[model samples]
Target: MFNHPQAERKLEIQPNCIGDHVRRETVAAIEVSGDHAARSHIPKITALTLQCRGGYTLEAELGISPNGYAEPDYLGWEVKQYGVRDFVNYLAKSPVTLMTPEPTGGLYREQGVEAFLRRYGYPDKSGKPGRINFGGIYANGRDFHADTGLKLVLEGFDADKGKITNVDGQIALIDRDDVVAASWGFRGVIGHWNRKHAKAVYVPSLMRAPPPEYAYGARVELCEGTDVLLLLGALASGAIYYDPGMKMERADTPAPVTKRRSQFRVRHNDLTTLYQASVHENIDP
Candidate 1:
């Protein structure tokens, strides 16, 4: 559906080192186009890259399945892209959905997704009975609640312990009645961290809406895996907030679904800790 001869040619060479070539070719594809540079109907940068490259394939073709395992986007390099209003302001938001299998021994987990929905499902703006996805800023020894009136208490955690202290002061989220509805154990978070494809090349793009289009290759950043560690630290420090995404109620199923996307988000300025090097350039009209 898209064509870029320059990028295709460059990709054909299949240089021994493909990471840098992908970056350069990506930039060229975006830069060469004038007003027509904007590609409507492509909502995400990943899709845009596939279109521009004109030949290279994505996750599947690269032998990476969704949520299967961590691997580089291509040639051992992970590519991430973000859109911004201007070069100065860019928000780095990633979904951290590890809260699954629920909590093995918690009351809510015992209740199961369907029962949980029946108890806490509230009408959304559209008045559809939507399951609540509970989230909040957490700190050591702080307390929070789920939509089903379940209370959760957080305690400072150590990697060795692999668990936190809940309201009863027992091991958190395990064998508890009034504990948090969901739990992200130390092992869970660490497991996610370990599987994450590190050494990413971040692409910041300038975007416009209505047609849902984008102009990418405005800037590129090289980030290390340690940045994810910093993100975890920020979570402990409360700089980042948990905002879980909820599954909308559907008539086809008996119960509404909860996506369990344990998203931790930071403000725009906070991105500096995640990136090591940055290069900015302007695209010509």
Candidate 2:
């Protein structure tokens, strides 16, 4: 379909590179539509970790190394700033914390151990040091500066009052009846971050099943007999615990709205590095 050799040569030329000949304009490879853009701004719960202090500071790498490796074997630092006087002031002032390093915002910060014990502790039981005084917080995903609105929905655990209606491929387009179609996505990797872990694609149909062309880059092996119930019943919503090799951990119940709103969480076993005692409660609204 070439009209002239010169025109064919024009086609052969690579995209303009520099100077006046260069094109100043460009188009985005990915264009986000209106509702999608709104979803991006609306924060969801990404992950939740217990904070064990009156109100402490949280740096990215906050933990003690059991073996004393060069770097901290433990990541996600937490501190408890609860002195007797600190507690007194905290009761009136709220949480006592270092404003500089800045605590992880959107944290659900429970009271100091003593105060929390008195508040939530049982009258019949009297155990001061046996894991009694545990308060907690549920942080919004945006609090971690994470990608808000993006939540990994487990199939079974995360659902609203209504049954999910439509599922298309890896994306579950659920019509909760209360709202328009909300999209849910699914992918199964080996643990959280183990790329070498015989990873395969597992996407249940949200609408019409995507053709084989859907699994382009990755290997796709169809599970011929997998029931739709299995996909529907898996965990859904909450924060995804990004434990390096294992990125998804399940967590707390989401606020029940229809549409596409969501949260993410990872499983407990996946978070091997988490200190068993770490905890916190969110500041009250």
- Give the whole-model CA lDDT for all candidates, comma-separated: 0.40, 0.21
TM-score of each candidate structure, all chains considered together:
0.55, 0.17
* Tens digit of per-residue lDDT, candidate 1, span 5-111: 11121111111223352233332232223333223432323433442221122222223333434444545556545544455544433322222223433444677
Residue pairs of candidate 1 with colliding backbone atoms? 97-262
Q: How high is the lDDT of residue 50 in model 1?
A: 41
The stretch of ten residues in a row with the least summed lDDT in candidate 1 is 6-15
Cand. 1 TM to true fold: 0.55
lDDT of 1: 0.40
Best by lDDT: 1
Query: What tens digits encode model 2's per-residue C-alpha lDDT throughout 1-285?
Result: 112211111111111222342232221111212121112333321111222321211111122222212221111112222222121121212222211110111111223223322333232234322233221222222222122112222332335642444332232211223121222233222111122111111111111112110000011111112222322332222222221111111111132111111222333222212111111211111
What C-alpha lDDT, on a 0 to 100 scale, does residue 107 get in candidate 2?
17
